[model samples]
Target: MSNVSSRVSLSDWGLEPAVDYIERVQRSDGLVPWYPDGPADPWDHVESAMGLSVAGRDEAARRAYDWIADVQHDDGGLWATYGETDGDEGAHAGDEPRKETHRSAYVAVGVWHHYQCTGDRAFLEALWPTVRDALAFACARQAPTGEVHWAVGADGAVYEDALIAGCASIYKSLAAGAAIADVLGYGDARDRWLETRADLGEAIRSRPDRFDRTWESKSRYAMDWFYPVLCGVLTGEPARQRLEAGFDRYLEAGLGCRCVADEPWVTVAESCELVISLAAVGEAERAREIYEWLFQWTDDEGVFWTGYQFEDEEFWPGDRPTWTGGAAVLAADALSGLSPAGELFTERLYD
Candidate 1:
């Protein structure tokens, strides 16, 4: 139940408090609300659930998965946001809104991960219908240009934007699903899906202009610099050079990497992501250092602040994010050689 990795030490870091905080959030129905005092969103819940599973809370993790499954729409998609509720009516009714493709795909990633950890074939089989339909829905929204649309409103309209975050997520989900299909013995389908994922990666690399010119801008947001590289869409010398430039430009001494050029705050998500990016490029020592730095943001309860502002005064607002913890677990898993999904893509077939 402890994260006793030989390569990293947690002795003086107050890890137990952070672990307790993660447990608290898990017990509170796997929802790490963004604002620390706001309503729970599905996105954070999915991420938090994965964190719980990583921390060895199998029962709680399964409950979190059940929570997501219980809220799925009739069309097999999940809402972008939701309140504390247990039924489809709660998720589907009210003025609460939902987005397609991105949110749905994200939830599927968590579910897929849970299945991988548990080897729960029946659980996966039960969700396979929903996962398949969700994949189809996401694929339907993919433009001929290979960019997946960001969202579909509850009104059934498309919100078309090449959000780098969403695009990165879709790539990961598709890759995960393709691997699952292969394991489930859908070899032909797996190859087809893998091919689609490859094409999408190529599109992302070849046509960065199509997504958002701002992402390609020299302004330097941590995500803009790191995500494409993390997703394996950016590779070899180009990715290495880009990450190095980001390090030189935006990294600070005590505060870690800034989300943007002018920002003095260090976001946990971005910082953790930077660790993964560093490892991806074979900078294991630096990556481990960054990972250790991430622990400083953890509170007495294992909850990490989204970020810390350092200019006028210091503050780490809100509850720890599921994405923050998820990123941590993912980075650790990658470093420890335990990510089954990562194993499936050993050769970067997409490139």
Candidate 2:
């Protein structure tokens, strides 16, 4: 409603170093490792790419998408995890050996984001097949009750339960995919994706029990708490109330949002995402307030740390994740309305 300013040029929101970190970790194939020798997850890789777009590195973003397309499996799935640059860039194993459904779907959001930033119709046209295939990989596993499953393995088996965080992200991917279809003149296909999006949103709001319930409950994770709002499946009064109910659960007044509700840790990324989520629900003042607090977590040189250990009053993980910087850039963009991709986190793309 307000379309307010977020005080950009004053700080660049530490994007310079964040961009540096993203570039440092990015392999020649455009695959950005979470850290050097780290397992590159698809969604985190895309977030880093989106950060590049926010910083006017459009070509980097496109190449990031290209790397995504290059490694995608024929079944429309990307590995839930990828090896380090020195190792096989396409090999899909990590600290664990399972695959995730959301990893494949996130490419849609990246493709649409690149299009929004560059207005590159040719780029969108080229990636349409990947978008179509990835969404199908995710959507085919949606339960009749409306929730999509969390991940699939290389063996081509489905994990029946859904993750609220993953599903919330997939919801955005679905909306973005439908929007992509609309741009490419796939009218019938777009309608189908729109229908699927609505059904999935209904499940997210009306059926939280449908997700990640059978396993250890993941409600402690802050992403599951705010993702629906951040992703636009929950908005307006519903979104505002959802955050209000959970404020005490994850928010730390002077630190940041917690990775887990009960943990006294504050992640720069989650804090940044909550800022966008607040703005999405018309809580712009609160959004800005949290955004201001986030700078406390950055380094002397500007790159943000992974998270702070508030209880110990120290840095917890001892790593400056590139995606953490990406989150800060995106949050600033959302608060300032600085770029086309700013609203990528704040506003709903589909009605």
Q: Could you give candidate 2's per-residue lDDT for residues 214-327 as a string of tens digits?
A: 799999999988998999988788888999999988988888799998888999999989988998888888888888887888788788889999879898799888888888
- TM-score for each candidate, following the candidate numbering: 0.83, 0.94
Steric overlap count per candidate? 6, 1
Candidate 1 off by > 4 Å = 1-16, 27-32, 35-37, 84-96, 213-220, 337-351
Clashing pairs in 2: 101-151
For candidate 1, lDDT tens digit of each residue in 130-155?
A: 66666666777887888887777768
Instruction: Give me candidate 2's TM-score against the actual structure.
Output: 0.94
lDDT of 2: 0.83
Best candidate per TM-score, number? 2
Deviating ranges (above 4 Å) for candidate 2: 5-7, 84-96
